[model samples]
Target chain A: MNLVLLFPILIPFATAVACLLAWKQRHVQRVLSITGAVLLQASGFLLLVSVWQSGIRAVQMGNWPAPFGITLVSDLFSAIMIVMAGLTGVTVLVYSLADMDTGRESFGYHPLMHILLMGVCGAFITGDVFNLYVWFEVMLIASFVLLGLGGEKAQLEGTVKYVTLNLMSSALFLAAVGIMYGAVGTLNMADLARHMGTVKQPGLVTTLATLFLLAFGIKAAIFPLFFWLPASYPTPPAPIAAIFAGLLTKVGIYALIRVFTLLFVQDLEYTHALLLVLAGLTMISGILGALVQNELRRILSFVLVSHIGFMIMGLGIFTHLAITASVFYIVHDVIVKTGLFLVGGVVRAERGTYEMSSLGGLYSSNPWLSALFLLPALSVGGIPPLSGFWGKLVLVKAGMETGQYLIVATALIVALLSLLVMMKMWADAFWRDSPGSAAGGSVVSANPVSFESRLVLFCPIGVLGLLTLAAGIFAEPVLTVCSRAADQLLNTEEYIRAVLGGIP
Target chain B: MEVVMSFVIGGLYASGLYLMMRRNILKLVLGIALLSHAANLLIFTMGRLTRGHPPLIPPGEVRVLESIADPLPEALILTAIVIGFGVQAFAIVLIRRCFETLGTDDLDEMRSTDRAP
Candidate 1:
């Protein structure tokens, strides 16, 4: 058992415990959180590098044999996901330093954030279906506390809806797990993957698959199951919102991809076709929702929901190229969405409101912020010379090759609509005259944003924007990594061997 | 015994879903609690019924010789129950706080976050 496989999960958990112990010392907790984030990034890189070199790695906890003991496994997909989680963790924590007030920090924000990261990492790495459930709960509980940290009336209202829906999701997830165990008599994911074809009742397997679809569909905010997301996501503080926008839903997508590709591919014609329908609906509904929203965060939240359809579309296609496109899209979406939300926070910080109707003149006053916003905004809209464009291009190309012209058309139209909405935001928030100010009030250059906060905030935004640009300009490496991960996913026997020690 | 347990589980799930559909927050919590219990029972039933024998394999033996019940589902149910309890407790406390602050337990009145003014 390699020790490195455990570090990505352990460091954040240890850091969370340390931060909790030092709760009274906010500065110490801040330093500890940042240090812990860096450590997490380093360890994630190490694991990624190792897994990239080696095919896949599995560690059986307590030395128990596989198919019996809880196993932590890392393939290229899981490792790359870990690395991305670490990246988001570092950026969001750094952003939180300036964006979050002392009120929330003293109330245990840093520790809960770390715990949340730990849970996300655990979910990415675990090899057991039941263990993934446990990690989901871990993420849920910590996220609950973080969401309602200051307990504002709006936050609490949002938290109630969030927690309610998520709890129902958990119950559904538990039910699926139980039924799966009864059907297969095992809880290990690799074991289940190997045994999926041989199950006595194929109908039972399909039922379990649908149960998982329901469970994860809610979490991923797909189509009809997405109302809880827009209701709650915009109520939290911006840094918290940014991280949630970045990681939470993607975790659900990760689970869906893992299972559908690895274990639940028995009846692809039925399951994948259902996913394609949901993908179209999700994309349409999400874009329409974004089009109507005037609030910057709300618009971005809907955009987040819409982009999930792109990844799901990839999954529905279920080809090697499609899965590769999905992985690339997931990477691009996580970075760009987080960056967009962070910029939204900056707008709110500068203007004291998220409603675009109340704000204006940002372009004349703060061209740099406008530029930062435009990078991710255009990227998310799938403009060329950005990371998001490549992901979309690959998915569309895959769709065309497979003769799924309708989905391809839907994707392109959604991309265009997304561009329109983003440009509308740009016009309203940056270019238009301030609502309260006179027509030519010179952009309200009163400097409401503090110098220190701007410096701290801009650092992460600039870094992430550059990373997005890098991912686009240097697409070959990222595409290589994604294709490798996709290849591993399509070939599940290697994973079963890695976990089960090649007994077959 | 198995048939009786199935009926009980079915009844719990029915009542649970009914309670969950209520607009009252307290009833919502009760519904969640009931549904969780039903889920636990459903898992319990899936393992089949064995009387007067535990799943213990004894001190020296590597496997149980007796036809004991499958223990994994029970273990899973136990974990699910603990998680359910935590979530339910949090839900109750949150509801109490919401009631005290907003002066309403009806889910309909809690649309402040959902509706746009």
Candidate 2:
């Protein structure tokens, strides 16, 4: 077993423990957390380099062979997600240092943050379906506490919705795993894929596919299941929301992509077609909902839900270019959504409100903030020459090739609406004159903000913003990596061979 | 055995979803617990039911001599139970805290986070 695969998960776990040990010293915890985050990023990049150079990497626990023992595997797709997780970890941790109140900080925020990161990285790397559920639970438990850490009424309220819905999804996911295990007599993903077709009941695979879809669908926040996200996301602090927005749902999409491409390929016509229909409805419902939201985070959350459809569309198309585009979209959305949330944090810090009605004059009072917000806002909203556009462009190309022009056209229309809505936000929040102190909403930043505090708060937003810009401008290289990752996904023999000794 | 377990699982799920639909938050948590238990049992039943043969290996034997109960489902169930216990315990405490803070048991009343001011 190559120990290199363990580094991404280990760094966060170690940092979390260190943070716990230095619990009383907030400064020490802060430094340890940042170092851990940076190390996580470095390790992820290192793994990506190795995977890119070699093929997929897999390791069995305790030197046990594949089918019986647990497997931790990373292909190009998983490695790229790890890199995104690490990047979001560093950015959100830095942002939290400034954005979080002392009450939450003193109450073990840093350790929980690292723990959440560890769980996310685990979900990305685990090759067993059951382990994925465990990782999701780890993430859920940590996030439950983090969401309700301060125990404020709104936080508790939001946590209730988040926790209940997520727990239900976990139950469904566990049940699916159990059934799949029973049907196939294996839990290793590669082995399951190998044996998925041989189940005695003819329709069992498709039924289980639907079960998996429903389970992951809730997590991914597709149309009907997305109500929890907007309700809960805006209730949390911006940094926490940033982390959740950037990574959590993307994990679900990753699972969907993983299983649909590998384990559930027997009935692509039914499952993939269903996915395409859901993608269209999801894109429409989510953006239309966003069109009416009055708060910054609420709007962004809706936008987040809508773009999930775009990724699902890629999976639905099930082509090399489409999956590549989907991967690129995931990469792009993670950074943009996180950055936009941090922008919300900064806006709240400066203007003391998230309600769009009361926000204005940011174009003059804080040009940097406006610029930072505009970069991600436009990127996610799919302006030309941006990261979002390249992903969308390739997705349209795939849709055209597959002759699924209706969904392609729907995607294009939704992209336009998203752009219009984002631009409306920019105009309402930054361009229009401030409604002044009288019209301000009740919610305000709990963190103390001063001119000097700008550096800490802006650091993550700036990093994420610049990353969005650079990822857009350098789309060629990233697209190459994504296409390779997509190829690995579509051709599962490579992944299976890496995990289960020899190819079956 | 599968027939009996099927009824049992169905009953648990039906009641769990029923409780989950109620307005009370405590019942909601209880429903979640019931739902997870049902899932655990489903896994147990699916692993196949064997009466007396335990998945034990005689000393130095390469493998089990009989078609023993598959230990994999039990192991998976144990892990799920532990995780479910942790989650449910935390959830109960959180619900209690919610009751204390909000001074209400109704889930609908806690709509401040859902609705924009």
Candidate 3:
């Protein structure tokens, strides 16, 4: 009877429908979008608080009993994720006020954004695997429209690769779900988790696990399956790109963690070992790719891929501490990466380009912007008293405690390399003069941002930066929550009982 | 009958994969459509074919009186088919837009974003 779980999802969906209805009226759409975003954030907070007090909450849609109907379950992990997602939705929607043009808005940008949020929240809170696939499609369709809305040549090109690859992943995902249903005759994740142990054919289950890995791996942008990310992420507007950077691939990682930990743990050694190898390669390839990129967003995109490696590394280690670290890192990364991408938006606004070579002297020109950028930049590089540093410290410690010295060393090296990439971006975009500017070419914008314009853009980045700092300084409470979340995820019996009500 | 359905599904999958790997955008869309059908068929076959019994229980009955076809797979396939239709329609429109905007259907040439100065 805990109807609070439905609000975070339904509010956004209702907002999206309202936005579409008011599509001809820009102000009305904006009001609905903002109101929806605020409501979503509010309900998300409520969900998290309730879940924090109560162990886990489950709601059967239409009052249908579990295993026979759609179930929405919220544990600490999902509740926290939904709250973080709500935060991203609110901040990015606000930022979009500055970043998105009326052309895009008139073309249904607000509705699509709300729909995207709905899909993201739905994925986080869903208790069924097939429901997750449906949510994935919801997200995919919205993202496709968002990416290609501008219809710029670059956007179209990027959308093609992005759409094609993502659709293929969807097909793979659907195929896997079909096979899984055929095998177990159940779609509820908790029930499947309970049934997997007695499924009689462990090998088929293992094969299905690998199939899911490949499917979610592509979504999460793991190595060898991540080419579509760098090719597409940089093509959209700043707000769109920032939200994508913040949430889309992470949704894939979330799916990976859920399925691997819940339904596929019977063959942990095999799957996790495979995860460890991919993590090392994802870290290495991503940083190396970033080292060579010159565009700020492109470089950030590569680093984004690399950071996914660290999260996966924790999952690979698979201890209570490691899972806790991964959860913390996910929260930290979502905030910092979104902040970094907003900084990218600022850079794009200040100098009409993402090319670091074409940009320079931002530090001197706008020290406030530089300060905003530096916090997340340095934090992402694992500087102490910054959020990324704490996540990295816990992950590396988890690695060491597990006697994974090579991965520990690789994690350390990746941290250093990440710092190097961040500094390179700083040196090129903020400190050094733009190469074109140095040559007296047209590097700076002709029309400088107005005070009002600056306020619109600066608020989101400043809030995100402050949050990052706060998370770092007040790391203890967040860690306790994360550790408890990890414990709940590992304790599947609790989840199954919560969902099924002892029916089994 | 099971073997025949299996071959049909396998053939559809092979053709779908071949078409997806093509350089043309239109073929890619067709490939996706083919794959969706294959997936639906696979689900149907996996649910096990039954002669003509619907999974309906008689009115006012607490349970089904006799063995019947599994209704779950049909429900799943129906949903998948609808979703697949939407995705395929979107894909076609996207390719058309890409072609109109970028003036190319060859996947190899859709590299405007990937290019360097």
DockQ top scorer: 2
* Candidate 3 residue pairs in backbone clash: none
- DockQ, candidate no. 3: 0.70
The top-ranked prediction according to TM-score is: 3
Which segments of candidate 3 are over 4 A away from where they belong?
Answer: A440-443, B57-63
Clashing pairs for predicted structure model 2, backbone only: none
Off by over 4 Å in 2: A437-448, B58-63
- Candidates ranked by lDDT: 2, 3, 1
Worst 10 residues of 1 chain A by lDDT: A439-448
In angstroms, how far off is A48's CA in candidate 2?
Answer: 0.3
Q: lDDT, candidate 1, residue A352?
A: 82
Over the stretch B1-117, how does candidate 3's per-residue lDDT look in tens digits? 889998999999999999999999999999989999998998898788998899887889989878899998899889889989998888899899888877788999987666653
Candidate 1 accuracy as lDDT: 0.90
How much of the real interface does each model capture, measured as fnat?
Answer: 0.55, 0.69, 0.69
Using TM-score as the measure, name the better of candidate 2 and candidate 3. 3
RMSD of candidate 2 to the truth, in angstroms, is: 2.1
Per residue, candidate 3 scores C-alpha lDDT tens digits across A331-387 of: 999999999999999888888889877788888888999999999999989998988
TM-score of each: 0.97, 0.97, 0.98
Candidate 1 lDDT by residue in tens digits, A296-382: 988998999998999999999999999999999999998999899999989888888888788888888789998999899899888
